[model samples]
Target: MREIQTKSTSRVTAQATDIVLRQTDSIRLIFRPTIIDNVKNKEAALKGIFLYQKKSKKAAWEDFETIPLSSVKGGEGYKLEIKTAELLQLFQELTQLYELHQKEGVPRGQKRYVQATPQLEQLASLSDSDIHSFSNANVAVGTSLLSKLLVWATSLDDPSPLIERLVEINPDSLSKLNAALGMQSLKNALASWEENECISDEEFWQESLTKHSFVLEQVFSWPTSIVKGKAYVGGKNVFNQDGNIVDFLLRNRLTQSAALVEIKTPMAPLLGAKYRQTYNVSTELSGSIMQVLNYKHSLQEDFQSLTGRSGDLFDSLNPQCAVIVGNAGSELDDPAKKKAFELYRHQFPGLTVVTFDELFDKTRQLISLLESEPRVEVESDDMPF
Candidate 1:
């Protein structure tokens, strides 16, 4: 008997082992029993007999034929048998058929099977020893590479590379990442204010808004198209003879009209003591409103002088005014008090009154929306500011 050794490779849980091909007048294939027990029926597991041929030592292995496995059997482990002469005849027929197709060109809608290169075949049929060796080496190499990458990332001053990589991997994550960064920045700003105890200082409040004007823009619902003008512009001889300075002066980009802003500490009162069984606006809030209105009046009175020097930047005829003052405390908790406050606010046409708490709360809600629904389009009417 001539023995033909064939490579055995496992593609499933059960492994085919000790595969040997013995040739007499007929060829017999024998293999050891598989270890798989999950299969309900062992006979059904045998599908077909596959034949592979290696044309030369340098050539890749190719499938020769697939025949029904039920035709031949050996009771011991598992076996198949086929006539040697018939196999040779089958090979000759296939070779002729392939040559004929090559000359005529393959018909449309039919694909000709192509064998993989030798290198790819070797990788697909890696030995058990090779698999264990690769697994062991991969663990050590992979761990070392990951550790080095972590160290490099932590040592870098800029995070753009890492952020870019994340965005490249998944573009949908960009908005969520941006929102997280924004939240961290806001936290840092709040922490700084707490540490420095500057929240109560009017000058510090103005400077903070000046440095990060986006916060002010969001609070006021100002469109990005508008331009923020000078801060603390002294009306001196131009707008007022008293030399009063305005906290912030803003102008519309398209109209070139100006607006006045007055900021107060959050600790200021929102409502004052009852007078004649009716709640009145706190002295702090009323004073800020009057101040902003005075600035507007002064600018309108001296519009000619101011326009000549500042290139007609102010719309003195209908300048808008806004006051950022105290938090909405217990006063707004009562329904009657809330109604009274709204009624008072509606009396002023050109002036807007916004509480510090309202602004901060709106900011928080905006951040939450960004985190939860990053891709959602926000409408202008949906914004509280």
Candidate 2:
């Protein structure tokens, strides 16, 4: 490394073209400084920090290969580009340098390392034995390395390295992996319902819809309807009169018309009892329907005020209302009970009533559609002469 010293009118600054701070048998870390244009007044600044690798210890420093670093258009901070191949060795060198710096005291204008994230703290706490055991662990070790590689690879300007690896994977295998992930999500949602069967907390159900607002989309016959922002819109309108908080407020992406949804637990009964010949809608279901209807009325009444405050144009004129409650598959197992429930909902105009199981059943169908392989028809050219 060539040492370059320049004198400025203010003070004298001394630096080297390449100052090796840390080194191993084959690799070395260096501080490269930018040479000043004029020796009179200009002071040289750090151009970059780099890692250089040599084939062997006996190799000349001039012939050392420079590892590529992330290019900063113009920034005060320096980012060293570390590849997966040299990650472990670089990590070891960095840790030792950090320890030495801590003992000596951090230089002026340089910030000392602090454990910010939980991940960094855990990494800092790892001992040599712990690191050895971690590196030797089975597939877990590979998984950790792959995760790091994925993060690094995705951040690159040209991510074709990761893309190439993915392309090498069989298409059928990729499809299967995608299907498995979809099935797992469906199973997780079902498991939540199963665990909280008896719990009738509206907030719990509300939270589920908030996380997976796609469930609300199934209520609308029009495919364009979607939850505008959050599933829950505040109860009160501009006037706050006759204010009733809606569980979910969906809008047609094309028409920009709004829709209201009220959520109830799956355990809520769909039908009460046989009145005359057909079953009557359960009191809980009846109340929820009325509640959603009232919410719609409140929204429509303050349509202009609400729309102005929201800043998004929403057509509150004749907005559709829906009530999602009960589990039809489990509760209305009887053909007669199912027919009565269906007839009532179908006959009800401007309002939709859907069962919990029915809503999730639609979600399952979507997953099935995603998992199903497309049929390719082959055109045969054969003449029967």
How well does model 1 score by local distance difference test? 0.59
* lDDT for 74 (candidate 2): 59
**lDDT, candidate 2, at 175:** 93
State the TM-score for model 2.
0.55
Model 2: ten consecutive residues of lowest lDDT? 1-10
Taken over the whole model, the C-alpha lDDT of each candidate is 0.59, 0.67
Candidate 2 — which pairs collide? 235-245
Tens-digit lDDT track for model 2 on 48-126?
3464545578876664454334543555456566556455654554444334333432222222223346775696589
Please give, for residues 1-385, the per-residue lDDT of candidate 1 as tens digits: 1221212234332322223344233333432322222357532332223443435555544445555556556763444355686556445534433343344322222223334568656855988689568758898865675577679799876666577777676555677766666887666554544454325788777777676565566544454222443444346755546665677777665676677878887777777776565578888988988888888887777678656776655465687878888767534778666766777766888888887666665666665665575477756766576
Per-model root-mean-square deviation over C-alphas: 22.8, 15.3
